[model samples]
Target: MQVNSEWEVPKYELTEFKPKAHKYCVCIPVINEGEKIQKELKRLSHFASVIDILILDGGSMDGSLNHEFLFSKGVRAILIKKDIGKLSAQLRMGFAYALSEGYEGIITVDGNNKDSVESIPLFIEQLDKGMDFVQGSRYVPGGKEVNTPLIRKIAIKLIHAPYLSIIAGFKYTDTTNGFRAHSRKFLMDSRLKPFRNVFSTYELLAYISAKAPRLGYKVVEIPVAREYPKGKIPTKISPLRGNLLLIKILFGLLFGKYNPRSE
Candidate 1:
């Protein structure tokens, strides 16, 4: 699809280069994120002029769905009324839209504004360097994990290790992180189902990293700097709940609950 340059801001022009190297579609799936969407949008809008951007909302009643920033050049907002309350399902819809729009790649990020939008270039960099999926690692060297509490950190390690090993036979320290970029061919070949409407994006990352690599798609982690606020949405997710969800995804992977073949 040819981008309309008139929609671009003064300092930015719609990047017209056909990414023959990669026709990746990017999705920033959002929920009730009113305060931070604009900032995130401005940063993303200015950054990925060459890629199609989709900001999908799952029935955000906070009126955040009406944000004008979503209409900026290289960005489009999708408001889904069937509120499923899960990050993965919302992302699945966004992926469908991106695919329908002829994008050959997809990237998913949290909409709560904790992610550093500047790191998007780094993701593209990794993708361009021949990665099927470039996952953001907060614990990797040179990557800073700001405001993550000690307790949550421990829980993250415990929950991720065994579940990832049992299901995908892989060991990644930071499996629950949401920041991910995917190649279209990988997504098509892996044939994993949309993440159930019950879990967050964490399990989705686990399934992909474990399953994709086994299928011959190059999966690698890139260091990304993350900054969380002093008392925001608590990057410290509940250990018990998170572990239970991880277990579910593990079972799904093992028993074939997610039928990538159906895709």
Candidate 2:
């Protein structure tokens, strides 16, 4: 499907390995993830028949996204971003493309293999139960957290989750987790206006976290496991810079800076 320019998505190249096979899809935003993404995709392959899989790549210079490997693993498509922007931009491409192709709901997961892909069925069950927004939470009762960095753990539990919960009028124990599901009804709501160019980075995620509850969407958080490798944190973000960015996005939410513009 040709993306309408008015949708505000970045220019992208998409390759479909097969026709759409499910009512939902898992849109993974990735770039230069090397073996991590391949391993994740392999794990996700077990659920291929249950939901479609697509990659929203930020131009991987690394030779990780081989088409044949993806096809062998049951990935249905890949959307490579050809324009500037970061994770949010790739996600914009993912959401817009999935919706255009008639996916009833979209599930987003980080492509780095930190999340447990096995718990995907739980999210689908919630979506089936009329949840407009489903956030995966490692801090919740049935959730598991393993080998997390002390600083990142503190930041998520102490700062990010608390701040977002207050503004969202909902207690969110795992606000930073990207393993979430969104219904078509929630995404199509005009009041959110998520496709704007302003959401180039972390803005869209934070904005949606706050706006979903305020707009009366049926929101819920389910337990899921997240584990980091025992040796080093696999991230491009420096600790100080990443926290600063999070603080900035949080402030924007505090002031309603990302609200939909009036027509």
Candidate 3:
């Protein structure tokens, strides 16, 4: 779908579950998140009336996101990615669709049932207050976390958050958290071409983290719970390889590699 003439997005097939019913939407990116996606949607469906729900599927063959289940959960639409890309490509598709559908803002959360679905309203409140970007954090006053891996925690606290905080000139406690919100104005900014093919993996999140606050957009961090289950964590990224690539992306962002050049 063409959000605007300037936008470019990955190829995908769109499936509609219902008509657009709200000004804001929740865009969840998933792949093979069987029960986790189902559980997340069920809990999130409580607020479906207030905000539309969308799924960006990365060609999941896990039989988790069938049309009947999604329709029953009040999903507004689903975009099954047929293109060769990862999380960021799916995001490009989701954001473009949301903007084209005339959504005023977008709230994005992980599909893996780890984040606080209850704190979704808090992000909505920030967006309604004219905030352009909002990052959710489990390290803040009212935020909570359970069963978070120690190494992952250490990397985020020591490396990721601090590096980005310095770049943005704003303290962000949870830089890696995908639980965030973005306004149409911020996403549509000419200086930040978020729809590009460059943001294929873990780059866009890092780019947005630093780029938004540095551009002097209205950015805020809200407290939210991120719980980890005691057993297996549902993550696609392998720890060693994923962390290295993320670090590379962070450094690239620092050097302005992802920044859109002036035409």
Candidate 4:
């Protein structure tokens, strides 16, 4: 793939996934996930031969990035300063690095370890077949969720998924899932403008989920397992604040608030 010279790729520390050629990079966006990240990195080690791993850390003070296990697992870390914002900022940083590095595509998985590492290959498989966006769906036929919080589950199924599907004009089982793959071409597309300031929050993923289909990209969802440990909070989403933000994003998409050309 030809690299785009226009994007001013910011400098960051780099570590190799291993001494080998890799066509795709798996980007795991994280905050202060200490032991959870360690465990997830170990789980992802199983695919070291097939794909490279990139850990995008949003100023983890827990020293999770410094853990010896991450190095042993051959996962690369891009530590973003806290001033950049949260999940969305880290993702933008990771995606920019991946594009500049010339990866064919990038597969994103949350660092919380809620998602199955086994589905990584499935994402790459679809990417290889030229899918622009490969979304992981726990509600699909072969997918399942374990120990999910009742309220969160209800919101995802009844509100988030349905609203996104309607806006995108496509039937979708999971729209809020972070376990998805995006072709380098799609990320580098100027019209999408994923690195814009508006994406500094949680809206980036949702916006891209809806924007991809609207822009005529091949978007598909594959079943993947999501398990919340017993007695553990399933997500970082606060019902009131997160839902309000989501509603704002949905309305913005409908009203052309985030359109690149409108800026």
lDDT of 1 by residue, 93-211 (tens): 56655554566667777777778767877877777887877778787776778987665677566766556645555456566677889876776553544434433444455667677
Which of the two candidates, 2 or 3, achieves a greater lDDT against the reference? 2
**Residue pair clashes in candidate 2:** none
Cα RMSDs, all models? 7.5, 1.2, 1.2, 2.4
* Candidate 4: residue pairs that collide: none
Score every model by TM-score: 0.78, 0.97, 0.97, 0.91
Where is model 4 poorest over a 10-residue stretch in terms of lDDT? 2-11
Which stretch of 10 consecutive residues in model 3 shows the poorest summed lDDT?
Answer: 1-10
Candidate 4 lDDT, 1-263, residue by residue in tens: 33345543333455553443588989998888888988998889889778888888777788877746676887755545445567787787788777767789999999998899889989989999999999999998999899877867777889888988988887888777899999988887778888766776778888898888988999999999998889857456676777778778778877877778654
The candidate scoring highest on lDDT is 2
Residue 183 alpha-carbon offset, candidate 1, angstroms: 0.4
- Looking at candidate 2, the ten consecutive residues that score lowest on lDDT are 1-10
lDDT of 2 by residue, 1-263 (tens): 65556688998998999999999999999999999999999999999999999999999999999999999999999999999889889988999999999888899999999999999999899989999999999999999999988988899999999999999999999998999999988997888888888899888888888988999999999999998999878688987788889889999889878877672
> Which regions of candidate 1 fall more than 4 Å away from where they truly are?
1-22, 79-85, 190-203, 232-240, 254-256, 259-263
Tens digits of lDDT, candidate 3, 1-263: 34776666888999997899888999999999899999999999899879999999999999999999999999999999999889999999999999999899999998999999888899899999999999999998999989998878988999999988998889999999999999999998888889898989888899998989888899999999998999876567777777788789888977888878773
Q: Give the CA lDDT, 0 to 100, for residue 143 in model 2.
A: 97
